[model samples]
Target: MPTHVVFIHGLWIHSAAWKPWQDLFEEKGYATSAPGWPGDRETVEETRANPDGLDNQGIAEICHHYADIIAGLDEKPIVVGHSFGGLIAQELLANDLVAAAVAIDPAPIKGVKVLPFAQLRSGFPVLGNPANKSRTVALTEKQFKYAFGNVLTDEESDALHAAWTIPGPGRPLFEDATANFVRNSPAAVNTHTAVRGPLLLTSGTEDHTVPESVTLAVVKLYADNTASVTDYHRYEGKGHSLTLDDGWKDVADDVLAWLAAQEL
Candidate 1:
């Protein structure tokens, strides 16, 4: 059987956003699917209309939801994720649940001590309000531009916001923010000793949501693990919207090339 790939999306973006990616991967001779989070509706409109299902959804629950989906695959598939989905990809790989993983602009896992100002600003929409921990939050067009499309043209940024943005559960952001203080935090990943499959972590240099410095810290956390492969790639001038914007193909093609180099 051809190698299978599972694409996991992050907060505020519906699973349907991955359709172009899925199509591209399939055309390249791989079987692919983009599965939504547990409570996600089938379409962007549907998800936007009824986002309460995602309220209070935390990191552990999201990880478990994807784990269950991976369990049913005939063979361990490669996982590719963005944002919180990137965090889930790492967790699943660390658990030996996937053949390999590519985390694009991933959220900071536990042990990441560098909290850049941009990251803080990006998360402020939820973190600014204590009550958001159990609620769902939506990003305004301005907020989306700042957090995800800062490097894109206003026209392109607004188009993406209108097409893909959805309500995101605030719980994961809350959990990630407090991960260092919480014991056995769900945002934690086993980066030190897991002799698992290869991992490729990518970052956009201009990413306001997850700055390159933050991803660099995560690379350091795995520095002791010489037994496993952990590669880092930096894309200059790219932003958090690298996975969904018009330039998404460049990022996707890079991932495809990396996977090919790994012979996966």
Candidate 2:
């Protein structure tokens, strides 16, 4: 089957960060699309300039936005997403909108426990400010380092932040953090459906943003969900930026290999 791989960017960074992945996927014959968020810009500088670009957006709206992009596709695309995008991929899969998916160090969806110190620390820059609930929150170099670049060298961390970081809507982080309290939360996932297709969840060993503990909980949530197959992979010494860090190609290659094994 001919597949169009739709790459989803997570919070802060816009779709531009996925260019390398898109190029590689297309080179392998998968048509690709990377859509910007509701009001995102072309570059990190542009997004940072328009810091309020993501104001008021939450999980459901963003998921539906990607759903709209998928609906316009010629085929049911394989969704590859990282960070918040990972959660979105799971949501899209739950809606039976994708052929297959790979979620790299995905933020926890509703019902997943939030006990890790690293998870809380990683989200602190935005979560610490309640005012951020209605506005955009940008990460500081130090904060970004702790959250996404702990495993990289100082130079690499700063460069990665400069190239990919932008202000993000704090509302979704707040919503995800408190999703269990909300009735019919958008963060909810339907793991019991076979139509959702095959899923592979990968976690970086040192990812504070979405620790392996969180991913493990996500896997357990699907334990009784035998209808849709789920697989797990863990990367040692990597951080939250696993998909974009120096070892990105290995991660991308593994995603392709997993899809091949699934015969997708």
Candidate 3:
């Protein structure tokens, strides 16, 4: 049977945004699926029209949703995720639920001490309001441009915002922000002792939402864990929109090459 691969999307982007990625992976002889988060609709329009289902959803809920999906699959599959989905990818891998994982510009997991100002500014849309913890928040075009498309051209950024952005639950942001102070936080990943499959963590140098410094810090957290493979890739001048912008294919091709190197 062909190796199965699952694509997990991050906040404010519909799973449909992974269609190009799914198509490319399938052509490479892999069976792929991009499942939405627990309450996501089948398409971007539907999701944007009715985002109330996502309200109050937290990290643990999102993790379990994907875990359940993985359980139903015929075999363990590789998971590639962005943003919070990237954080979930790490959680699933740490728990041995997937064959491998690629976390692109993933949110900072627990134990990370460096919080860049850009990251804070990026998250302020939700973090600025405490009540947002139980609500769904939508990003304005300006906010989306700042957080996800800062490095892209105005035309490209506006098009992406119109095509793919959606309301995101604020709960996960709250949970991640306080993860360091909370016991058994859902945002925590087992980076220290998991002898699991190989993992690749990528970051865009100009990413405002998840700065390179943050991803670099995550790489360091896993440095002592020589028992497993942890690789880091840096894409200079790319931003948080690296997975959806016109340059997405470049990032996707690199992931394909890396997977080939791993013989996966």
Task: Encode model 2's per-residue lDDT on 169-236: one tens digit a residue.
Answer: 98889999998898888888887555578999999989989888999999888888877789999998
Worst 10 residues of 2 by lDDT: 188-197
True lDDT of residue 21, candidate 1: 92
Where does model 3 exceed 4 Å of error? none
lDDT of 2 at 203: 94
Off by over 4 Å in 1: none
lDDT of each: 0.96, 0.86, 0.96
- Clash counts for the predictions, in order: 0, 0, 0
Which pairs of residues collide in candidate 2?
none
State in Å the error of residue 205, model 3.
0.4
lDDT of 1 by residue, 1-264 (tens): 999999999989988999999999999999998989989999999989999999899999999999999999999999999999999999999999999999999999998998999999999999999999998999999999999999999999999999999999999999999999999999999999998999999999999999999999999999999999999999999999999999999999999999999999
Estimated TM-score for each candidate: 0.99, 0.97, 0.99
| Candidate 3, 1-264: lDDT as tens digits | 999999999999999999999999999999999999988999899999999999999999999999999999999999999999999999999999999999999999999989989999999999999999999999999999999999988899999999998899999999999999999999999999998999999999999999999999999999999989999999999999999999999999999999998999
Candidate 2 CA-lDDT value: 0.86
Backbone clash tally (model 1): 0
